[model samples]
Target: MIPSFPVDVERIDPLLASEVRRHYDRGGRTISFCSGSFLLATLGLLNQRTAITHWRYAEQFKQRFPHITYRDDSLYWYDGRIGCSAGSAAAIDLGIAVIRDDFGYEYANAVARRLVLPAHRDGGQSQFVQKPLAPVNAALAKVLDRAVKHSGSGSTVEQIAAKANMTRRTLDRHFIRHFNMTPHQWLCERKLEVARQLLETTHLSVEQIAGRAGFDNAVTLRHNFNKYLSVSPTKYRQTFKSSQQPF
Candidate 1:
């Protein structure tokens, strides 16, 4: 089901509310697929809860609900009461993972093979998001596109500010006004965004990811990761996302 998150919160209707109530009462897990993560999140049930969403929209998702820790690196994230999947394909992985957890590894393996994907992967939705961005700023907006394309190289705020040809203070203001974050914050988010990609797409170690993400070390990476994403660096990788979910 579609949720009004990153769109409108008041738009969630009575019918959907009733449905959610029923789901809650059923005593089963409540899981959101992709944008549907917005629903559980908006209901505030996901606050301080482990969850995930489509990696491409992770930045906007985090911006809209800072209370909820957005785990982009996970293939499928679940704290039992709530769950978030990475993207479309990760949904299948989530299904299998849940089945394995609920049923057994043998059955889960059967399901995974039936779906024709590897039984498991290293971690979160990170592999699925390649860090696509919409350039909306004026001067630095031109550089935003370049920034995302080379996100793997790790761009710094000072360096980016210079590229935008604006004073650091001006760039910081623009970042907040345009993207709802300071320039440094936005750059960190961007680095993490692509970090997920490398985690999933490449056989990189945490140290390598740290370097590519412009983080000083795994500890620093974990610090920033825990501050915003709310999940440990290792746990984020094994997470999942599913588009077939009904929310």
Candidate 2:
């Protein structure tokens, strides 16, 4: 069962929490969506179990329940009879999984088809999380913005630093402080995001998309896609493309 939010586990009536626990105690399969995991944790239902929740709430979950294994990178996790999902879309994925387990793959696939969703998504929450730039000084923010705008044009870190009137070392420092990543890493993620979008929305060939996304070639794009997303570009397109048209 899913709990409604604004979840205040601390303010929830003890009897209500006990009733929820009793539901689980009676062999009820529980699926917690997003912040609902907090309610389950309050009832000790998630203790020693691997769970996932919205990435934005991951830190708070960790702080509150250090004993539970919190898998922040997964869209959802199924541990025996208890399951948890990352967010709204991920909750749909978890529901599909439940259907698959209860019936079979064919039933789950049919349900997914009816919903116009993929039967399963590859990779994890990292692929869906917004990689926001760190709030930095105004000058650095402008520099980062320029880099993002030209990400598809293969702008180098040196060029970005020059635009910011800073040395390479200074640029690296600012990037670490503001983004927790080197300039190169941030640029690669930006390019990959562009490539993923193009793959989903367009029928561009891999080579064409690679050029548009600032990769050297289709091979490079494949390598990076596999490394970062754990799926090939073609496979990613197949999974997320809205239409059944041949690529």
TM-score of each: 0.50, 0.59
List model 1 lDDT by residue over 129-150, tens digit each.
Answer: 2223455667677788888788
Task: Give the clashing pairs for model 2.
Answer: none
lDDT of 2 at 41: 84
The lDDT for every candidate, in the order shown, is 0.66, 0.76
lDDT tens digits, residues 1-247, model 2? 7744454456667787878888899998888898888888877888878878888888888888899998754778865488888888888888877765554335556799999987652232222322345578888788778777877998888888888889999999998876667998888888987887688778999999999999999999999998887779898777666554322
Provide the clash count, candidate 2. Answer: 0
Candidate 1 TM-score versus the reference: 0.50
The candidate that wins on TM-score is 2
